[model samples]
Target: MRALGGLWDTTRGMTVLRDAGYTPNEKHVRRTYRRLAEAGLLTKVQDRPVQYRVESGAV
Candidate 1:
């Protein structure tokens, strides 16, 4: 999640994560975000391309 901190949303987050040397399967990344959202640690803002914001204090 620290890798995702400065990113605008998940697509950028994944790109940054990859660039930072973290490699999870694409489906796993998406699923992890979904789980985070369900747990209220993240909030989905848009569906097209799937954008999300980490909840306040989530870090």
Candidate 2:
């Protein structure tokens, strides 16, 4: 989704989910990102805390 369009931190996704009226916790955010990466919707950045981004120019 738009939240993962660029290099995004998982915490930021939690914030986005919260702003959208969902009470997603850290685990939910991580799971979502992992799944998206597996599904090729996101590319995972191998950082300590990890980061994910959608393909360039992708929606």
Candidate 3:
């Protein structure tokens, strides 16, 4: 997820994943972000665009 930068939304996340050689769609990106948030590695900051902030020490 660090490939996504400190702050990102689903669209950027998909690009990051794709660049990393992963086949990702919007659903996959959202799911991955949700999992990261649940693990405390990320925090959801917006709902419309599904923005997220990387947690401190997550890098």
Candidate 4:
């Protein structure tokens, strides 16, 4: 969650997490993103590749 918190304004992609020190694979992050989206704690932006942002005040 620290990673997400620190990236509040940035649209985070799986690759960003990997580059930012997350140890898990991209698939793991993708799954977690999906769950968060379903829970309404995050929003997924569709584009060339999907990206995510934590909901405002969700933390």
Candidate 2 TM-score versus the reference: 0.81
20, model 4: CA deviation in Å? 8.6
Q: Which segments of candidate 1 are over 4 A away from where they belong?
A: 2-10
- Candidate 3, residue 14: how far the Cα is off, in Å: 0.7
The residue ranges of model 4 lying beyond 4 angstroms of the native Cα positions read 1-22
Whole-model Cα lDDT of every candidate shown, in order: 0.73, 0.79, 0.84, 0.64
Range of the 10 consecutive residues with the lowest summed lDDT in candidate 2: 1-10
Ranked candidates (lDDT, high to low): 3, 2, 1, 4
Better of 1 and 2 by lDDT: 2
RMSD of each: 2.7, 2.0, 1.7, 4.4
Q: Write the per-residue lDDT of candidate 2 for residues 1-59, one digit (tens) a residue.
A: 76445677778898888999999988889988888888777888767779887866455
**Candidate 1 minimal-lDDT segment of 10 residues:** 1-10
lDDT of 4 by residue, 1-59 (tens): 63445332223455566687876666676787788889988777654466666777675
Ranking by TM-score: 3, 2, 1, 4
| Best lDDT among the predictions, by candidate number | 3
Better of 3 and 4 by TM-score: 3
- Tens digits of per-residue lDDT, candidate 1, 1-59, equal 64445434556656767998997566777887888899888888888878777777775
